[model samples]
Target: MNTSLKTILTASVASLFPLGAAQASEPATSGQPDTVLIQAKKISAPNVDGTSQAAALSASSDSAALLRDVPGVSLYGAGGVSSLPAIHGLADDRLRTQVDGMNLISACANHMNPPLSYIDPSHIGSIQVLNGIGPVSNGGDSIGGTIRVNSPDPEFAMAGEMLRKGQAGAFYRSNGHAHGVNLNATHASDAWSINYAGSLSEAGNIVAASPFKVVSQGNGGKPGLAGDVIGSSAYKSENQSLQMAIRNASQLLELKLGLQNIPYQGFPNQRMDMTGNRSEQLNLRYKGDYAWGQLEARLYHEHTRHSMNFGDDKQFWYGNAPGMPMDTEGKNSGTLLRAGLPLSERDQLNLGIEYQRYRMNDWWSASGTGMMMAPGTFVNIADGQRDRFGMFVEWEANWNPNWFSQIGLRAERVSMNSGPVAGYNAMAYGNPASPLSVPGAFNAANRQRADHNLDFTAVARYTPDSSFSIDGGYAMKTRSPNLYERYTWATSNTMVMNMNNWYGDGNGYAGNLNLKPEIAHTLSATFDWHSANPDQWQFKIAPYYTDVHDYIDAVPCSAASKICPGRKDGFLNLSLSNQNARLYGMDVSASALLLSTEKYGQFLGNAVLNFLHARNKDTGSGLYNIMPLNAKLSLTQHLGHWNTTAEIQMAAAKTDISAVRREMTTPGYTLLNLRSSYTWKQWRFDAGIDNLFNRFYRNPLGGAYLGQGATMGQGVPSGIVVPGMGRSLYAGMQLKF
Candidate 1:
């Protein structure tokens, strides 16, 4: 159960068995810059000079699931498909996740299309995660971290025709009744070739704690959210994607298109059922090698439309009590472009610019008694034609091969102009002008505004030789306040109380339209080492820290405050103007070849461990969502065309870092996963099981809700604090013609 015991057992036992070893071998060629490439049989990514950056790379059963394995990254899920990954306790618009150079920002107040949501994990070739202020070329909005997902590249281009000339492959995997499929095709003809990929998946209700009990009413007893839990809730989702690529030795071009549709019925989260929530994305890119250096260009666009409706289902309860009916629709869209060109041999540069827009319009049709409260509300809160333009540049210089440095800068301007958000007060409470008091009334106003910010980053890399290297970086960036934080006008729902204050509920709430952007400064360092013949041993370690200023926080306000509803203790437009925070962590990765032979194939053993800590500078309290110390042991074996692998991952018990704000605590847990694959002639097949033991445990977020013991399954809480998936199995295959 302890880290030392687990490590000793994994190394001593797993290393002795070929089935528990990785198939590590020398690279086919030398002189390549990536001399210490960490090529585990199951996952592939550029090893920063023999240093393995832990990234959860796999056919994502769900995009957010992939980030769970990455150190310092955690997802806030309401126990289902609507999960959003948070980094270093930062999420929503705070972190940036890009795919093939394209950015995917979310538009939902509840955060539906978080960066990862648009990506189909199975379609990704590799993933790279920079814990904090990684590469400026990756772009800067990461006060927490940044993740880059790369699509599978052409394989035949490097190995040649004998290995795989005209090969086509397909894969299918199912877990707990949710099934996924992938189809891939590749062709090579001496120089010019093409690769294509497509994937689709569907899932059903997730099972959670069942028949749990609690006191229904609050008096002298613990105030619980639900009196007694019924049958556990279920979640369902479907996603699909397509990618086409044209590449040669000197040039490459790729076109990617994806569509995802999720409609949940009887699931947790909202009172109204998610009717038709769909997302569409299109991306294109071109890269080539030039005599001077290299040049690459990219363009991308995405659209998301979400709708909600409440029918005869009694599940549509209001304020934790049976009440009104509701319905609405929302949408968001954007476009971006980036280009990189080397200016000189010792200096390389990248430039990027982008434009984006967002809008939301919703109509509600409430009937019967609830209709009388707020009839036919045409609730429209749109940032009509909101615009943003940004320009960024990165320069890399080599002070010989032993030392190099890179610096990046970005400037952006944003403008928002739309009508004021209008909705019924919903609660009659005390005001005669409240939306509930005056039914079918339009109370919110129209609006418009503009804002701009500048971002900066710099990094230095030192490599004394091919076997060892070190890197350090620093950055400064800013993020504008979101529209909802500034202009939302609605009476607070007394049922959903804020844990921070205990009474900031239905009394009355107001918005602040004058909030400024949050700013951040970060510093990071990494060290890497590898033997000349790494087929034997290698080691890598990275430590990082970040300091953020003007950190945003929400608090309750008294009705006497400057903002409206000053006399009531509720969620008014209260903000922390000058706040700061810091986060630090270390990640270590090491591998040793246990056995290697041409006849028996190769066997290698590897492990990765990480520890992270973060705190609010203002309160010296623990930051939210920081992952606990954890480690993973993996073994891969190869026998000609047959291969097998197994891994054991462990998480240490966690103590709350964010004090006062109760965080969910998890007990140390160990999990075992097994995988095997075979190749016959021109065809290949793979199969694996995740969480083989079907263990059950709740994450920090899920635990936080249980602690609240209030109206939990509402807009903010929404079962997001429940445990994740249990034991699951999957299999896939590919063929060559």
Candidate 2:
């Protein structure tokens, strides 16, 4: 790593230790660096900082892939940038993800524009993952966890001085013919400062390993196999942001504006691809310190216009399916206020209020020559709207040096409404007298729904000495269904519910009006052991369990229902519902200095292990798309201005799968990766080769291969497992001034 990058990594690792006892003292100076911490009080939850984020972004083009190695966290591959993250088998809307204190909603029905895709990796200052458990004040309406991505803080010059700084970098990769560039510049004065960042990236179809092949049957009854390419997996995107900050004696105010444009992107797992995406965002924030304590307030808004349609690959699969063009628009706005107060010498309290409003519409245009009509069909989710308001209070106390505890409570109200819906051949499934005519009845009735939910958390830490500690927590979390989950109104039997296809099961589905909220009860514990010196060696282990009531699932629909069109795969029609579920998992990690010498420098070793088990308790069936047991081991060496690392990643075969969904099984494989860096003055260079051995493997959670370019053997199933990437070489250079 470069000297500057090495400094950042060191600082991030040091932050994992206890603040007062582990941090080294620094000499007072006239100029100080800008820093921001975003946790609620002191809690005993397992969390991972941004070190992994920095490493992953440096090596790959997708930001969501960064979480795959984090303990207790896994990824559901959907596209290059739209991968959905899962914790303990829960994913998508079940988790809360925010960028710079703003929550962004995806406008595409297939979720082509997830929250993480809105922020470029070059502008990310920090990323924090609260695994399994999170403070009530930080988030609500989530049972999984929270992911926070923050931009670099604005900087102001010291008294009687002005400062200017900037950095430029570029990178290229082989397997996908991918390349990208990023630039950042900032100017600061005594009272005001300005900052700007921009990035551009593009990639072609990804190449699979040589041993991995896609067998397809052509229109002529001839079967053919293709090698080393997953077609239609291309994308291009651009992002830009500007920020301004004003500072006074004890207060600071900041404003930011961001713009994003994505002309096209392919999804190998979804039925439709992203043809266009344009978005704009504005945010305003204030931070102040007073006699009572500290206060932070923020207001933000985001708007997105997205379009999706069948790409060339898809057009080849379904030749005369008509040009299915769909357009969607979304508007999101929110406000937050939080304050901290000191009650006494040993007690403190934090309180916050939050509110958000969201609106969305989805409609599709006909090809002018389709099966039933000439003009078009509308109302996938006409005039869909959701509003939420929440309040939370938390208290932290230090009974003594060895014992610290925190307790918090949160309450929220969620409301949803939508206008009338209509589709092609509505009358076929819309008979009002039929018991299965919910879709038709919903269109006739004005739909309005509301839910009141509550959550609580209690955590404590016990430490007898500086080298060891025991921490534990218990939490109750709740989440109501999203707008799409309750308001997707389409009568086409073959219209697979794309929003709910995160698992890539290749099943058609529809929404339910009577679905209830999911409530989760969880308990977690962690044990930490470290050397007395606090810098040589360390080990940490965490175990967690959760039981959820009314967990979301899919079940067979009645044959007479309007949406019960059978698919080509011969699977029965399905609808969303709630069932009881259980999940338990454990994470183990360790790091140590193996050797140190003045002549050879330092050598370090690190390892991690993760395992999880999930099941639908009510039906005695395994959960879909759960990650198999996995582990990773790595070694690092530093000498003079050069740094190098070697790593091995391994996973066990997965057989446990949901019978109803007909989930596929995968065989295990191991991979090797190597990376190195060199720095000189203000210039740095990095190079790495992933999958060094050119190994061919299948990722159990990688989702099914729905790409149209590939052909399958006659009578072969459609749910073929997608293969991992082939060997690739990457190089990057950065210059700072």
Supply the global lDDT for candidate 1.
0.52
For 437-546, candidate 2 gives per-residue lDDT tens digits of 65567776657889999989888888766766677799999999887777775545455344334346666567777778999998888776666775576667788899
Q: Tens digit of lDDT per residue, candidate 1, span 148-227?
A: 66666544455444323333333444443555555555565445455555555554444333323343343234332342
Clashes of each: 27, 4
TM-score of the candidate numbered 2? 0.90
Q: What is the lDDT for 510 in model 1?
A: 34
Which ranges in model 2 have alpha carbons more than 4 Å from their true place?
1-41, 47-50, 53-55, 211-225, 316-322, 372-374, 425-439, 496-500, 559-563, 570-572, 709-717
Best by TM-score: 2
